[model samples]
Target chain A: MADEVILLDFPLSAFGMRVRIALAEKGVKYEYREEADFMKRIKSDLLLKMNPVHKKIPVLIHNGKPVCESLIIVQYIDEVWKDKSPWLPSDPYQRAQARFWTDFADKKIYGDSRSVWSTKGEEREAFLENFKVLEAELGDKPFFVSDTFGFADIALVTFYGWFYSIKTFGQFSIEAECPTIVAWAKRCMQRESIARTLPD
Target chain B: MADEVILLDFPLSAFGMRVRIALAEKGVKYEYREEADFMKRIKSDLLLKMNPVHKKIPVLIHNGKPVCESLIIVQYIDEVWKDKSPWLPSDPYQRAQARFWTDFADKKIYGDSRSVWSTKGEEREAFLENFKVLEAELGDKPFFVSDTFGFADIALVTFYGWFYSIKTFGQFSIEAECPTIVAWAKRCMQRESIARTLPD
Candidate 1:
């Protein structure tokens, strides 16, 4: 148990959920402080001092310093806990490829998928098209990184949590549009670390 | 001299330029092949094979595996040549900070900064406002990293090159609009590696 690690998080946030999975997988114990009143109380004064700009959740306060950004936090955890279960590949090229896909998920998939939640007509169609692109790329692969469940897999899985919340389950329909990716997401979630941290 | 590394790039591209600077900085030698005239040359089979989805440049082919995206490519180079010269910090917390800033440059700065290129108006003003956010975050720091140039520095400098072709430079005036960032860019460009690669 590392007393220095404190995660200021909420279970509902996909960003915070991702960090929780990383910590669980790494088997690193830390104080989990739920920020219940972010809108009202503004949560921890320590968190505010830690990240002044964004001042958002999913803040990982480690040994007194705070690190923001979900994916960035995962990368940090991977680097620090390298001796533990590896989140990223040891090979540089493989690691870069992993990052590329992770970034693709963040920029292309996350943004477009979120749009599907609030849109209709041509906008919804455009969102589905983006989904198709991801599906086409992910075709038949069990994980984004070939066989292993790495950082990219974790990122994709984190976003997939949004699937249940959006029309992705009924309207957008991942099985029809992106059957392969859907299966991939399902496979990733089966992992205990991931299964435990998914949002309600 | 190792001759196996291959880079699929176009000199005129800002993304490609980032890779060139990284390679130069690390003194990594590689064979370069530019993608010919994008539109008319779409029929080219080589590119389709190298990058099927995005079909973007700055792809590094190491040991026959193609790695796409500029930041990913830079990270690959850093990881491969980790011992030569460290472009990113080794400390996990510091690395996360670097990554957070780098993602900010990609999503916010380089992202919104592109509006300046699109035939002026409210969009261009939006772009200037985006640049101000970066300038404000940068403040008086000599470098984004404060003393040494790192991943975030490379990202911003590459974006600065893009600013040249955009109409925004004339409209906002770098020296006047954001002198600190302009000075920071100039200072980063002074480095031998950055100087050799930044566009004329």
Candidate 2:
């Protein structure tokens, strides 16, 4: 039987982008349902029903069962489609490391970026400093977990589309602050999966 | 060669209890180093070096490499000791569901519990209401993931000891609010792993 896969998402959400990238990476065909009035705080009934706990988008429904949380959904996609592009490393330790950095991106980078967007003056400065930590982690690597565009890369590069808005609102040049990270993001964009899935 | 495992933790921490529970479940012997001055904000050199990103407790060191984050550490332990009692479900869908509830427990339950502990008035009331949602999820399930005790159960049961403090500070009876949840927690407590590791 053919799989029925659907993603309930908002266009600009980095979380939503993660799921899109994972599905695309695996060459999995899925129905993309963008929440029209998501920003206006209007949630679709399907979104609410599928993810009653969070009532948030980026819920991946496979054969009618909903998987909430972006990374979890990405992992689900990877697991179900293991024959194709593997998002996580095969080694358990390396997998743990990938999860650690993906989590770091989720909690710190995404979180600090939001803080940078919302705050001003010293608070914003503190948040921007958090980005330097990410830059240090990125270093000269082509991707977050070495040469491969893996889980951490997918977790992070989704935010690349928002870099312009983040820089504009936060009044900072990401390229100037973290040139290598920007370069790595651009490298990731070369992939059809990422380029196609990530918002412009 | 025998594997060396070490857990740097604080005695009263619910997060630390999670690692203890996982290790105990696998019957993996390890050094349990309690961070005596953790509450005093003094981080050990080992803890700082091992988990510089978070620099927090419940850092599980397996053969000198560190895996921070309680749930991640638990997952790592499960993967490393796969031949032993499996903490995560074998099926991908079930694994994702376990992760979903585990994430929920981590984000919502843990966050709300802390809010209930720290706040007063309507804020505390709102946080307490969140527990009812958990109760509904618990329903008549023997554990968070039906008949077996798994990741979600481990993620949540660690906080059972803190329920007393949450109730005392927030002025609420969990048993009155969510009797089934309380019963489920007690059932988990029967396990030697949980009984030995969970804070008193």
Candidate 3:
């Protein structure tokens, strides 16, 4: 039986972009439905029915069932389509490490980005300090998990698409602070999967 | 060769209790190091060294390595000790569902509990409204994922220990709001693994 996959998403959401990159990586075909009225507080009934719990986007509906949460959907994609490219490491500890950093990106990076754009003075400085911590973690590694464009890479590189807007709103230069991370992100962008899915 | 496992945790923490319960469920023996001075703003060197990223509790140190984050640790325990008992379902979709609710518990439940305890009037009312959403999800299911007391159950039921304090602080009866959820929590409490690990 042929698989039917549909993604309920918004174009600007980094979370939604993560799923797109993952699907593209494994060469999976999926219908992408952009939630145009998402910002206006109007959500489609299809989205609401598919994700009753959160009523949010990036819901992957596969054969009528829905998977909510971006990271969970990415993991589901990796598990169901393990043939071509593996998003996570095979070893248990390595897998745990991958999850930990991906989770870090989810919890910390996005929040820090928001704060960087919305706050000022000492508050924005504090958020910049947090951003530096992420920079230090990236350090010399080509990718977050060291030499593999896997889960953490997918989790974080989506933010590269939004760096312009974040820097504009915050009045800061990401390249000035974290050149290595920028270089790494540029490398990830070279991939057809990431290049195609990420918004300009 | 014997396996050496250690859990660095705090007794009062519901997150820490989660790791304890999973370890007990798997019948794995491990050293439990209570972080008595955690509230005093004093973190042990081992805790910092093991989890440099978060520098938080519920770190499962297996052999010499550490796995941070409660859900991640619980998943790790399940993966490593697959022979004894499984914390997560084997099916891909079911596992995704379990993870979604578990993530909900992690993101929503703790913050809602804090608001329930620390606020009053409309602020508290707003949190109570959020709490009801969780109650609604529980519905008639024996567990978050049907009949099985799996990942989502473990993620949530640990907070049952704090319900007394929350109810007292908020001046409300959880039983009145959601009897089914309370009943399910009671069912989980009957397990020796949960009974022994959860605090009063």
Better of 1 and 2 by TM-score: 2
Task: Please give, for residues B1-200, the per-residue lDDT of candidate 2 as tens digits.
Answer: 99999899988888898989899999899999975365587788888888888889989999988899998898899999988868777789998988988988877887766567654678777776777887988898898765788999999898788778766766777778889889998999999999998767
Best by TM-score: 2
Name the lDDT value of residue A60 in candidate 3: 95
User: Model 1, which residues run further than 4 Å from truth?
Assistant: A33-49, A115-142, A165-170, A176-179, B36-44, B117-142, B162-170
Which parts of model 2 are misplaced by more than 4 Å? B118-120
DockQ of each: 0.66, 0.79, 0.76
lDDT of 3 by residue, B108-187 (tens): 77756667765467767766665577788788888887577899999989878867876776777677776777898899
Ranking by DockQ: 2, 3, 1
Clashing pairs in 3: none
DockQ score for model 1, please?
Answer: 0.66
RMSD, every candidate, angstroms? 3.7, 1.8, 2.0
| CAPRI grade, predicted model 3 | medium
